[model samples]
Target: MPNLYFCIPKNDAVYFDEHEVTHMKVMRIKEGEIIDATDGNGGKYKVIVKEIGKNEAHGNVLNYEFVAPTDGRLVLFAPSGRWERLRWTIEKAVELGVDEIYVFNNEHASRHYDDKQEKLELIVREASKQCVRYHFPSIRSIEFLDIFSIAPESTYILDFKGRKIPKRISKSVGIIAGPEGGFSKKEIKLLKERFKSVCLGKKILRFETAVILSTGIFAMKLGKI
Candidate 1:
């Protein structure tokens, strides 16, 4: 497979952003080298590097292809936790083909990752490139109760007391994984009232583990994995 990078396409050319320019430098990509890049909106390009500057790289678009987005979106609702664990969850979630990721603050959330949207988006972009994904996932923070408005019927809450994940999910769905501290009774009651609850198995999982596990399960059910 060709190495993938992110780019901004001009009329007949593509420009690598500063971050990607830095990546190019680290990879020692030279002029005249052919590379693959994505616009992150389904457009993938085959480009020939023409110039490498201190802050940018310019390429001529040799070929372009548009990949249609996949069916049945998989959205993840994960609770705030330690930055390292949360970062891992985000990376794996993107690799697992999640369409959107929302970090929520709940009663039992151990830590608040406030004002980390930029970092989160960077992670999403890097993960997308790593996986050669033509379409990139969106990431943001949200209030815990705000989830109900974003596809309630298809959303599932991960909890030890919930039912086993079904063989298949027929529509776009969201999976919610609680914080490391677990859910409080009131929050659990509210969640139970709004979303279907599903369990990975009998054993309880850590916040990041549950997020990845439930995401993988949902991705498989949606035919993404």
Candidate 2:
């Protein structure tokens, strides 16, 4: 089987940048080999390697296929907590087929996110390619309360004190995972009023854990898993 790779779509072309070329070299892929690649926007391609250079490669697009978006989407609302914790959550959530992930400000968070949009975007791309997903999950950072502006079609706030989440849920679900230290009392009051509260279990979970469980359960409920 040909190895799978990812590329940024340029008009009707896909260019393998330095990072991708390095992987190609590691895989011993050479000129004349056919490889599968995704544009991360529902477009997949079969390319025949035409030329290779020290830091880049060119391919001839032989064929293309378009995959439709997933039926269910999780517009996850999570705190901008520890980078590693947030990264894990993002990678797993993308692998599980989350449609979108958004980070929000948390007053009690261990550390706030910095201006690392470039790095964060790369992480999402890699996670999508790692799982061979048909579409790239959208990731964004929003001001604390701005999250409500684009609230889910069906919003469910994941909390420890809420009722158990129902097995069957709406196809388009939005999940709100609390901060590391849990939401502030004032924040909780706002959340309760904005969304329907739902619980994952009796025990308390970490910020990242809550994201995983909440998104996973909702995705499974929609049979998107």
Candidate 3:
């Protein structure tokens, strides 16, 4: 098999027209040479060069394969930590392959990020390309409890207040962590009523540590990793 290059269209033989032909011919690739291509849609294609002309090159289509982009679950991450930790969490979350991320700016939240979503998105993009993944996770702007209430089901809040860590994985999960000062009593109560609060054992964890650990453990339980 030849080296691979990612392009827009996927799962078909590529006809190297003009520019591409010049590129390949200049590189001295011969007829019948195999090449690989990806469509950035979780699919890969292998093709064999059939003809190489001055201005164009045609290929014989070969087999194709795909890896599903969307994992079975939708994940919601409520931002509640410090800068260094939150940034680290975002990177790890992208590496772990969370579907969606939301940074919640609670009334009592400690850290306020000016461009948290943008920073995290850059991290996800780099991680995605490094992993050769066609799709990258989505990160939304900072929000509050009022915004979170309407989110999809299967929500989980990673709080130390609850008993026992979560063990089972479902179709979707939303994890909420508090700030350094922790959530206000009212915030805790409201979240408990709206979303299930999950404990991460006896030891109290820093906001950033908790965020990364919670998502990592959740994926492990779901067998996604």
Badly placed stretches (over 4 Å) of model 3 are 1-65, 110-117, 146-150
lDDT of 3: 0.65
For candidate 2, what is the TM-score?
0.90
Total clashing residue pairs per candidate? Answer: 0, 0, 0
Better of 2 and 3 by TM-score: 2
Q: Local error of candidate 3 at 103, Å?
A: 1.2
Relative to the true structure, how large is the alpha-carbon lDDT of every model? Answer: 0.86, 0.80, 0.65
Local accuracy of candidate 1 as per-residue lDDT tens digits, 141-211: 88877877875478888888889988767678888887888788988888888888899888877766777
The digit string of per-residue lDDT tens for model 2 on 51-117 reads: 7798888787889999888786677776888888888888988877888888888677776555767
Across 1-225, the per-residue lDDT of candidate 3 in tens digits comes to: 134434344235566546456556656879988876555456666768778888767776686788776556657566655666666776777766677767778777677654666666665655554555555667776667544654557777777777566456676666666666667788777777877777777888876667777887877665556
Report the Cα lDDT for candidate 2: 0.80
Among all windows of ten consecutive residues in candidate 2, which has the lowest summed lDDT?
1-10
Order the candidate numbers by TM-score, best to worst: 1, 2, 3
Q: In order, what is each prediction's RMSD in angstroms?
A: 1.8, 2.2, 6.9
- The best candidate by lDDT is 1
Q: Judged by TM-score relative to the true structure, which candidate is superior, 1 or 2?
A: 1
